[model samples]
Target: MHRPAVHRRDPRLEIITEAVERLIPRATPAHLTVTVTETLPGTANPDGTPHKHTWTGKPEGLAVKVFTALFGRPRTEEQRSPLAQAEDAKRARDLVGELDALLAGGVALETAPWYPCRPGDLVHVHHRAVGDVPLTPAFGETYIVGDAGDGLMSMQLLAHTLPDTVEHAADMVGCFAAEAADCPVYEVWFEAGAHLLTVVRDGRPVHVGGAR
Candidate 1:
């Protein structure tokens, strides 16, 4: 009887073969040749939501396709419209003004008197059944106002690096609450390594922190 010639496989090839076997248990060495194709960007779907990718082939290709689907492509600055950019700028400006008014004595926490920084804008606080207190902004810091909801508004401190004290965080919350007497409550979000402060207003934030 003639013995068939035994073929030797490279050790590195064997390692890869083992990995492939683990990846696709049902596949054999004969099924190793597979074609993978990726779709170009801007491919549309039936519903009009762009089809992110068109990955075809074996299990490995499927894995790549799944990842691409989960984390879509990042948007470039050029992708944003000019109108959208302008809207963002306007929002930032408004937030800055609100922050400045809150930081300065523009917003009044008490019933004494308050004046608007700009003409045609109403900035007054309604008197509520709460105690009035004076609060002041921290020295040499910039803040940005975020969303206001549930009688609470959020403010974030802006700094090149993290804040160095919990005292500034507390002072910010206190000052915000004092300015907005009607808001009864204020929340402050500071930078990393800093603390959060919650201020329950005895008066509205509008009353204490007179609006601009």
Candidate 2:
């Protein structure tokens, strides 16, 4: 069973989330279902370490149709607006190129302040890409696509969360890892046109779906 989530606050988290919501136009009640939740600390991987505080949630619109069909829920998928589609694609490519540049630049964990919700700290940002879907189904769901590092993953590696900015996102760069920089695989998704979602670690400034 999934354990109950925790609650905490970070200024950066709020900023990023607001940015995503404002920046991405498709994440409306008419288009998606977005849920932001905080995760409690727990056991680490086999390396015997403590877990980190985490946050995760789905975007507002992508799965409305499929999810509703699968579970008899309401139909909330927006009309598949052309503007939304175009915007999603452009953002996905932009994010991919941006992350690639960060790696190429040799940037590291020193970019942002360490997340306050966990034991360890920011390490690096690992990135993955998924193609031709409603959104990048990285980590098993849709999200604004981006890479993450181990400092963010120590709690629950590969967990997904929405975006919130607390004045720390612009500075975040490169993938982080506590054990192996490329150990556990991460997934990211991009819709055909106007949306890109990435599920990165909490307190690390990596948020899924588009942040404004």
Candidate 3:
């Protein structure tokens, strides 16, 4: 069969690379076969296009272990008790509320330094956390924002402060923001659950009220 041309660099490939590196950091590819999922623009007529497939990369072992360390392992009915199940339901809602509260008054994403994402229609974001906001963790730490429900938001930190001479912090004075002008930015808290809510549709960053 005739297969159409594929992009030179698949972002899923990059994600797999990043995930592996984030953990192993240095490892020779020998027998490592990873499985990744990709959404492609498929044949369309009147219905919708559905061309979703998986890229091979184990998405298991280390990455899964690390991810689980941050976000607990998903439980099945056989494994989880009824009380645990009830708690799990409430936990999902709690996490959403906590995430919302954290990013309640956040500014645009591009305004931040070293965001993992960039602007465009095909914005690439492999969220570190779950729920509405998939904020990245700090130092692979487990953080608790609200009352800290089972520490669901733990391991990954969602809030960060942009560096500044007049606005940047001491630690962020000369780093992180260097590439802020070049990459697409996802949503970032104005300053850790303090600023206003603003999602960036356009590449332009909105830097109006609030400060980190």
Q: Pick by TM-score: which candidate is best?
A: 3
Per-structure clash totals for the candidates: 22, 53, 23
TM-score of each: 0.17, 0.20, 0.21
Off-target runs (Cα >4 Å) in candidate 2 are: 1-105, 115-129, 133-155, 158-210
| Candidate 1 Cα outliers beyond 4 Å, as residue runs | 1-9, 44-212
**lDDT ranking, best first:** 2, 3, 1
Cα lDDT of model 3 by residue, 1-212, tens digit? 11112221111222332356434433333344555667767554356766677755443344445544655542222222123333555678776544543332222232232232322212111112324442322121111122214322211233443313322234432221212232212222222210222222243322211111
Worst 10-residue lDDT window, candidate 1: 189-198
Error of 2 at 198 (Å): 8.6
TM-score winner between candidates 2 and 3: 3
Which stretches of model 3 miss by more than 4 angstroms?
A: 1-17, 21-59, 69-71, 75-184, 187-212
lDDT value, residue 209 of candidate 2: 26
